[model samples]
Each structure stands twice: as structure tokens, then as C-alpha cells.
Target: MAKRIGITGNIMADQSGPFPGYNRAYVNNDYIQSAAEAGGVPFILPVIQETELLKEQVSQVDGIILSGGQDIDPLLYGEEPLQALRKTFPDRDAYEKELIQTAIAMEKPILAICRGMHMLNVTFGGTLYQDLSHASFAEIKHDQEKDPPLKTHHVSFEKGTRLHSLFGDSARVNSFHHQIIKETASTFKAAAYAKDGVIEAIERTGELFVVGVQWHPEMLTKKHEDMKKLFSLFMDAVGT
Candidate 1:
């Protein structure tokens, strides 16, 4: 059977549509397409606060894709909102925090991307820069205004990391995130880093196949073979 991949979604307020002022749960189509292309059944798990409902949602999927969205609430990591901090949805943060904990408890594989990566880090006792401007070491342009599929900067993988196994020592990736991992969780390892020392990827130390990438690989999979392999690796882990 093809793996069932649950993608965490974001809540958007309908501004002028039929349901004006109402909220809608959505995940980007690229994430759905990426999961399907990787040979998994994709399901968008809407943002909800009910703990039992969240557990039931995770119970139905073989793995989880923590999809990208708004900035993580700074309070999640015990910090006040900085001047450069962007918009955030605390309810979504609460939902994903529980989702990740439930997924880990069930030993489900996870592939976190962009903002999802930020959530994963916070969930694991790590912190984020909030905005690249806060990190003096992050000299490169991380939030590129170019087309989503275009590569913007280079990243080097650690020798023994899964990223290195897939892309060797170095690879160029399209970056679209303003926040970067400031400190990785104790249980996870930084797998790849940008030329400016920003973390590009992270993975749990154990064998549960949890990984997070700072870039939007879902947007690159269609044009980059390496990106496709990254998704395939996650699918393989889900299958196991």
C-alpha cells in the first residue's frame, strides 16, 4: 500500500470570498504534489486545537509533513517578540506542537519544511533567529524574491548525514525562509549548513527518520533530481 502522508495546514482568513471573515485550512499544492510524486497518499490535516482530534489525525497517517507557513510565535521558545519578528498564529503553533509530540510518540516519520522546520526546532528545545537580520552570521539572502523553483544559495552537508548521502558535500537550494535555526535541539543534529553558517537541514539522532530542511524542497522536486530523492527518502522511511 502507498504510505499515507499527513500534511499540517495553515489557517487563512477569507478576506473577500464567499465566506468573508471566515477561516479556511489549507496546505500549499506543491506539498501535496510532492507527496503524491513521492508515491504517498497526501492528506491535508487541518489546524485544530482538540487534542483527541489531533491524535486521531496522526493515527490515520503513516507519516507527517510539517508544511511551511507563517513565523513561529517567539513565545514558543520563551522569548519576547523581537522588532523584526513577522506575523504568527499561536493557535497553529499549539496545534503543530501537539501534532509533532503525538507523531513522535507514535514513532511516525516526519519531514519538516521551512516554517515547519522552525516548529520542529522549538518543539525539541531549540530556538530560532526570528528573522535573518537578528543573526549577524547570516549574511546571505535567505528570503529570495525570485521564482519558487529557482536556486538561490549553496549548502554543504555534514559528511555522515543523510543529506550528504543524497547530495554529496554541497548543493545549491532555493531559500524562502526568514527565520533560521539558532540552536538545534539536543536530540537532533544539524545535517547541512549554508555558506554563511545558517542551518539548512536537521535530523533527529535516533532511527525514527525525522528530518527538517530550511528550504522549500517541494517547490524544487519537479525540476531538481536531488529534491525528488529527498522526498523519496522520506517515503522510504515511512514505508519501513
Candidate 2:
């Protein structure tokens, strides 16, 4: 049987529609398509406030993909909001926090991307830069204005990491995140780094297949074999 992959969704209020001010739960089609093409049944896990329902949502999926979204609330990591901090949704934060905790407790594999990577770090007691400028060493243009499928920068993989096994020492990837990981979780290791020294990827220290990438592979999977293989790696970890 194919594995069931749950992709976490974002909530947005309808603007100027018949149901104006009404909220909708949605995950980008790229995520669903990437998961399905990677040989897993994809399901969009909507953002909900109910803890029990969130737990049940996680319990049903063979693995979880924490899809990218808004900036994380600075208060989540014990800091006040910075000037460059973008919009944040605390309710979504609450929902995903529960999802991460429940999924880890359940030993489900996780593939966290962009803002999802930020949430994963914060959930594990790590912190973020709030914005790229906050980190002086972040000289590279992480927030690329080019098309989503284009590779904008290069990241060097740490030797012996799963990423290194896939892309060797260095790989070019699409960049689209403003916030960057400030301190990785104690239980996780920085797996890849940009030429300017910003962390590009992270993975749990132990063998649980919990990995996070700063880039959006879902957007590149259609054009890049390496990006597609990243999803395949996650599915392999999920097992049958």
C-alpha cells in the first residue's frame, strides 16, 4: 500500500468574495502534486485549533510535510518582534506546534520546508534570525525575486549527511525565505550551508527521518531531478 503523506495547510480569509471575511484552509497545489508524484497519497491537513483533532489528523498519516508559510511569531522563541519581521498567525503556529509534537511522539517522518523549517526549529527550543538582515553573515540574496523553479544559490552539504549523499558536496537550490535559522535544535544538526554561511538544511541527530530545508523543493520537483529525489528520500524513510 502507498504511504499517506499529510501536508500541513495555511489559513486565509476570503477577500472581496461572496463569502467575504470567511476563512479557508489550503495547501499549495505544488505540495500535493509533489507528494503524489513521489509515490505517496497526499492529504492536505487543514489548520485547526482543536488539539485532539490535530492529533487525530497526524495519527492517520504515515508521514508529515510541514509546508511553507508566514513568518513565525517572535514570541514563540522568547523574543519581541523585530522591525523586519513580517506578518504572523499565532493560531496557525499553535496548530502546527501540536502537529510537530504529536508527529514526533508518534515517530512519523517529517519533511519541513521554509517557514515550516522555522516552526520545527522553534518547536524544538531553537531560535530564528527574524529576518535575513538580522544575521550579519547573511550576505547572499536568500529572498530571490526570480521564478520559483529557478535555482538562485548554492549550498554545501556537510559530509556524511543524507543531503551530501544525494547532491555530493554542493548543490544549487531555489531560495525564497526571509527568515533563517539562528540556532538549530539540540537534537538536530545543521546539514547544509550557503556560501555566505547561512544554514540551508537541518536533520534530527538521531535516526527518525525528520529533516528541514530552507528551499522549496516542491516548486522545483517538476524541473529538477535532485529536488524530486529529495521527496523520494522522504518517502523511502516513510516506508510502505
Candidate 3:
């Protein structure tokens, strides 16, 4: 039997299309493709506020992928939104929060990407920079705008960490977000860090198979062998 992987989908409002007044749930195809490539059956779990339904969905899946999307509301982590902060999804945040909590309680393996990573950090009692500019460290352009994404920075993984085991000490990955984990939760260990001190990767401390990355590995899996291996490793955990 293939491992059932539930990937979180974002809610999008179609303004000009035929469904102008309707909202649709969607997830990036790259995530589904990567899950399939890793030998898992991918399914997009819609964002809904109903806890019972979210719990049911979590119970059915062997693993979960918190796909990237809008920024988390700053108020979530006890901070006011920065003046420059834009685009937030409270509904998605609420849905994913409950879903991930339920999934964790069920001990389901989880892989969080980009904003997904931010959610993990917050859900675990951590905080975020709100905006990269708020960080006092040396600045790096995190929001990379290109025709197609490009690797813009190198992340060094700590020895003996899961990230190090997966991608060695250092590897370059694409950057496409402005918010980052300011402080990791007590349950997670910062596994990788960029040169300017931005957290690049994190892993759960004990037995739980929870890993989050600030970069979009799903987009790079087609071109980067390491990203492919990372997804394979994630699936291996899920299959277990």
C-alpha cells in the first residue's frame, strides 16, 4: 500500500474568472508531484475551520505536508503586524494549525515548506520576525523574484542534525519569502542556518518525524538531486 500523504491547500479568491464570487482550495502541483515521486499517494486537504473534519483527514493520512502560501498573521505570535506586512490567511492558518496539532498527536510524519515552516515554528510556541527587515542581523534578499525560482543563498546544517544527514553540511536553495523563524520552539532544533542567521531548516527534537524548511524543495526537486533525496527520506519515514 502506498503511504497516503495529505498536502495542505490554500484558499484562493477568483476575482475575474467565471467563478468570480467563489473561493477555491488549491495546492501547488510540485508538492503533489514530489509526493508521488517519493512513492506516496498525494491528496490535497482543503482548508476548513471544522476541527472534526480536519481531524478525520489527519487520521486517514500517513503524513502531512504544510504547503507554502500567504504570511501568517503576526498577531498569532503575540506581535502586531509590521507596517509593510502584506497578504495573510487567517482561515488557512486556523485550519492548518488544528490539522497539524491533530496530526502531531497522531504521530504522523510532517514536512513543512516555506510558510509551512513558519506555521510549525509558531505552533510550537515560537515567534517570527514578522518581516525580515525586523531582524537586526545582516540582511539577505529573501524574497527573490525571478521568472523561475533560483538558488540565492547557502544554508549550513549542524553536524548530527537530520538536515545535515539529508543534505550534508551546506547546500544552496531557492528563497521566496520575507518572514522567517525568529526563535524555534522548544520541541524543535534548528538544523540549518543561512550565513546571515536566518533559520533554513528545523527538526523535531525526539521521536516525531517533523521537519520544516524555509525553501521550496518541491520546486527544486526536478533539478536538484538533493531535494529529490529529501522527499524520498520523508516518504521513507511516512511509510514506516
Error of 2 at 171 (Å): 0.7
TM-score of each: 0.98, 0.98, 0.97
Cα-based lDDT at residue 66, candidate 3: 91
Candidate 2 stretches with Cα past 4 Å from truth are: none
Give one digit per residue, the lDDT tens place, for model 3 in 1-240: 879999999888788977796888889899999999989999999988877888899989999999999989988899988887879989888888888789989999999999999999998799998788788894888877773346788999999887898888899999898888888999999999999999988999887789999999999988888999999989888957
Q: Across residues 1-240, which tens digit of lDDT does each residue of candidate 2 receive?
A: 879999999988899869998988898999999999999999999989988888899889999999999999999999999899999999999999989999999999999999988899999999999998889999999988779999999999999888889889999999998999998889889999999999999988778899999999999999999999999999999953
Worst 10 residues of 3 by lDDT: 142-151
> How accurate locally, in lDDT, is each candidate?
0.93, 0.93, 0.89
**Residue 33, candidate 3: alpha-carbon lDDT:** 95
Which pairs of residues have clashing backbones in candidate 1?
A: none
Clash counts for all predictions: 0, 0, 0
lDDT of 1 by residue, 58-93 (tens): 999999999999999999898999999888999999
| Two-way TM-score contest, 2 vs 3, winner | 2
Error of 2 at 74 (Å): 0.8
